[model samples]
Target: MNTRQIIIIALLIIALVIPGSSLLGEKEYPKFLEEPWDHSPITVYIDEQNTPPHYSPSYQPTVIRALQYWEKGGNGKLSYNPVFELANTSDADIYIMWVENMEEVTGAEEGVAGFCRPMIANGRYVHADIVLEVGDYKGYSWQQYGDDNMEQLVTHELGHALGLGHSNDIRDIMYPTYEQRENLNPLLVQTTYPLIVISILIAIGISGYLGVGWLRYHKRRKRLENELLKEMK
Candidate 1:
C-alpha cells in the first residue's frame, strides 16, 4: 500500500479498536457510591395560636409522619421538635406557619400547588410556609384537605422545605405528582440501582482501555525483537 493508504488504514484501525476494547469486561467492574449532601438538622414548629385549619389536632400527627419519612428515606439523622407551647427560645430552624386561607400562601400561581420561600438565617437558614384548607381536600384539586390527604401534601411539601427538589420517579415521595399518602419506598431511594450500574460501566471502560493499551505495546515489542533476530541470522 502507498504511504497515504497505510496512514488512513492505521487511523481506521485505531478508531475501531479503541471503542471496541473499552466494551470488553465491562460487565464485571466495581461500582462506587456517591456521598450524601451535608445538611443541618431542621426543626418544624407548628403555630399553636393559629386558629381553624392551621392549629387543628390532626395537623401535628401528619407533620410528624412526614418528618419520620424523611429521616428514614434520606438516610439522614434529623431531629424534629414539634412544639405547641410558645417558648421565647426555640431550637427549630424551619418554622411552619400554617394559614387557613389559600390566599395567604405565597407563590401560588394559577396552576401551582404550593409556594416556598427560603428564609435565610445568617445567610444560611431555609424556611417556608405550609397552608392547609379545611374543605379543599375532598375535591379533585391538589390542595390537601382531609387527614389522609393532608398527610400526603405535607410529606411532599416538607420534602421541599427540607431542601429536597422534585424527583422524576413516580414512586418517590419527592416526585412532583401527588399519589396517595404512603411511606417512603425503598425502591425509590436516591441511591437507586441504575446509578450503580452506570458507575460500574464507567469504571470498567477506564480500566479496560488502559489494559488493552499495555497489551498492544508488549505485543509490538515482541514482534520487533523477532524481526531483528531474523535479520541478524
Candidate 2:
C-alpha cells in the first residue's frame, strides 16, 4: 500500500526465494569410496627403518597413539578400525613413514606436515601410505609436539587414506592444515545440529501461524453465513 510496505514485501519475497541452508558455510567431506569400510580392521605398519633417526623408536609410540586416537575419536563414523601390527612393509595394508622433507610427497618447500597416498582398485581403496614431515617443526622437541600435535597430524592423514578429502572447515580433522589443537572444534563435529534445530523451530512457528489464519478465516465465513440467513428471514 505504501513505499515502506512495498519495500518490506519485496524483502520478504527475496528471503523466500533464497535457500535457507545456503546461509551456513557448510561443505561436503570429499569421500574416497562409495561405501566406507564396514568396521573392518585396517592393518597399519609403522616403518621403523625408513623413519628419520631423530624420530625413531620414540616416534613409534606416537604413531601407535595416533592410530588409537582415530579408532576411539572417530565416533564410529570412520567405519574402519586401525589395527597396528609388526608386519613387514609388503604385508601391511597401511604404512606410516616419517620424512625429513615433504618436498617429494607435496610440492611445497616448507610447512608440509604430512601426505597420504591411497591405492585404489575396482573403485575401492586397497592400501595407503602416509608420510609425516617431522622437519616441518624443526626446533620444537618431539615431546612438545609429539604428544597431541603428532596424533592430530596422523589422524588427518589417516582420514585422507580412509577416502576423505581435505575439508574447508579448519575445525575438521580432514582440514588441509594440521592444527596443533587437542581435539576438533564443536562446529565441525556437528555441523548440522544447530541448523536442524533452527529448521524445526521455524517449521513449528509456520504451522502455528497457518493454523491461526485458517481458524480466523473459518470464523469469519461462519459469521457471514449467519448474517445472510438473518437477512433472508
Q: State TM-scores per candidate.
A: 0.45, 0.55
Taken over the whole model, the C-alpha lDDT of each candidate is 0.47, 0.58
Q: Model 1, which residues run further than 4 Å from truth?
A: 1-40, 53-55, 74-91, 103-107, 110-113, 121-123, 134-144, 178-233
Candidate 2 collision pairs: 32-163
User: How far out, in Å, is residue 57 in model 1?
Assistant: 1.3
lDDT of 1 by residue, 204-226 (tens): 44444445554555555566556
Model 2, position 87: C-alpha lDDT score: 60
The superposed Cα distance between candidate 1 and the true structure at residue 216, in angstroms, equals 41
Model 1 quality (TM-score):
0.45
Spell out the clash pairs found in candidate 1. 121-125, 137-145
